[model samples]
Target: MNAGRDAQAAATERALARAHGLANAFLASLAERAVSRAPSPDEMAAALDEPLPETGSDPAAVVDEWFERAERGITASPGPRFFGFVTGGVTPAALAGDWLASAIDQNAGLWASSPAAAQTELVVLRWLKELFGLPVEWAGALTSGATMANLVGLIAARQWAGRRLGFDAAAEGLAGHSPIVVVASTEIHLSAVKCLGTLGLGRKQVRKASAPGGSVDIAALATLLRDIDGPVIIVGNAAEVNSGHFDDIAALADLRDSHPGGAWLHVDGAFGLFASASPRLAHLTRGIERADSVASDAHKWLNVPYDSGFAFVRDGAILREAFAASGAYVVGSGGWDPFTHVPEMSRRFRGLAAWCALKAFGREGYRALVERCVDHAAAFARWVEATPDVELMNPAPLNIVCFRIVREGCGKAATDELNRLAVRAIQEDGRAFVTGTIWNGQAAIRAAFDNWQTTLDDVAMLQAAVKDVATSLTP
Candidate 1:
């Protein structure tokens, strides 16, 4: 039996090696293109459908067949031209670490179960804290993404706030406690409200504050805080998703200091938190360190693969008390038990990918890469400003540039249709890809520069394509 198992393992490794090579080649091909061809429903069903095996077959053959069928259907979101969402291209070191993590298949619930994983996570967390200028003693946990990280941070805030009001909300539910009001900017991510709903706090329970340039309106926020009767949790944006605008953290922290009733401040810095790493952009995120809690995504500006998010809290004891599970099954005394900090019992070894990326790139290397992307975005914005048939929609604050294709002698509806048609043409053309969004109730095109593989030449090509499409549409 041991011999058979060893043979199967070796075969599986061989198959994986071959699959990796093919996948890398496919990714390389996408550098010169925009969007990948979408697979039809029939193609997807055929690739995913399988029968239960009555008898074991060769693992090598099975792996090969799986890749062959699935490769064409896979979305090239990892490619250079995928700029629709707030997604970042994964670094090679991180991808390789993910491969090793899958091979280890360790459940990083506690140190005893996977000491190496726990230690690595601790190291990564410390490194990240230092990188972002967070308090060294603060506690953090690896989460799936910003959504889960926000959920965890908000849970901690809720617990800490509940304690001040003489209630153990975690132990005894929020049955009789005053309703907790969550205050955030109008441009805040929808995930915050979703988190409230998941926590049994109604979505409508949040008080929306007006924002200027996507940052929280300090005046509006102060008014909301004064008007609210019960405990309040102030949610601030580090980088507004729509325009990459940052909130005035310094001013917000000052308000927190003067408020009579204690208010928990949570910074939702999913992709914006990393701006602190760049000396050029660090000033934009001033006072981020003063946040009571911060949630960021390692998969975004950190350039790590997916399933990497972090939640940092100033009070370690609060996080452990709020999230720690106690029962007959759980072991009491051990090195760091991740389940004590985050809401997960069986989590993958996510720390490996983050640690590997940091070790391979070093701090300066990532900072330089991010700076380059920002420069590219600024140059693209300048190009849009220069073009006759293009109109700049918003100031390119970070890496996202919003603009629209100008239609000659066309009405608002016609111009809107032209912009929509232009984006579709770029995707269908496959040389460049961009998506459209409504900005200030006007349709506009957005080109996000987050991929490390993207270059000035690619940007120029995309700009030229947009011009060609717009020129063709003119009557």
Candidate 2:
């Protein structure tokens, strides 16, 4: 072998070994690590910023130095007590699969380029559909995250809507076409609004569908749909962010039927759709199968690594027409070409980790994981109500607990301030991590239990931290 090749191979082995050791150490320390310890931006920059060297350095040494610096800034999100958002911890199998994907370096953009990537992705998509109780035949693609997934689904909807209006929106653009009415509840996720903006359907043009407490008022939606004269797109929520309440999707599906212009039903199922994985929680996503398109995040509840999303469309032909690229260099393929269904042409091999995870855990394993998180949230809500100093802001419909601090004889403003202080204090205490939010116009602390590692002891620790902080801040 050439001397250069021999040296490179040895370097690669050493670098990989260093990475593996660092990963193991991090995972092992999660039990005792603080959920968060954010380093100041200036400090982090000082640690990581340096001028590029003219000469090559030892790859293994560089890896070790990077790990040491990066470890200081990492949030213990994979730990049991992390409740900041609907973030899921990576499973061992998923992490291992991710490593394999990088080692293989497969560009999963074209079917001909990597047949294994395409077929494995197809299998993973099928498994997800079955897990979520969606139709197995639905066309789906894995994207970077829910945002991209929502954009892909909305692109298809825009085209479908344009066709109903006797125009090809993809080719002709939205200039001469009749305005497509994008209807959404006020509770719809911000990502949906972003999707509309990205699709050139002005976000301001979205017709507000009045839904109180995250439940779509079917009669209100019907009246709005009845009056709409143009192509329609209705966005529904599988799980509302603050309360985790699910909209009546079946009712939304019925309204789509009687509309003047057949409405496109799209569900933003971000973290909530995982509820369907649990038999006890599946009722929340009832009639989700009726949606014309669905957008969800695998990174959130699937416990996969960052940046994995799913976009599913009932009409495969329409999805392909909306996104499929054509050029002399892009060869025709009988196999599944991912670029045909998704927005990206150069895609990462994200499906491998998701596939490994689903295969490792199976259906029953996921059910237990999801159900346990929901149960934890429910228990935390109960504890909040039982504790006189704290009050539940909303019913724990799924896996999010929103609560506020209450002080005897304190005014509303004072109480809100105390709750705000409590949140900040608890976060700084470094025992557990939770986020602050406003629920029903009141300042509140939100703990979303989605991490599979979280246990009852972790929940107790969170309760204690909040109680201590709130009591200390009380007047």
lDDT tens string, model 1, 343-370? Answer: 8988999999999999998889878878
- Which candidate has the highest lDDT of all? 2
Query: What digit string (tens of lDDT, one per residue) describes model 2 on residues 118-152?
Result: 99999999999999899999999999989998998
User: Residue pairs in steric clash, candidate 2?
Assistant: none
lDDT of each candidate versus the true structure:
0.83, 0.88
Worst 10 residues of 1 by lDDT: 31-40
True-structure Cα RMSD, model 1: 2.2
Q: What's the C-alpha lDDT at position 82 in model 2? A: 87
Q: Model 2 off-target regions past 4 Å?
A: none
TM-score of 1: 0.94
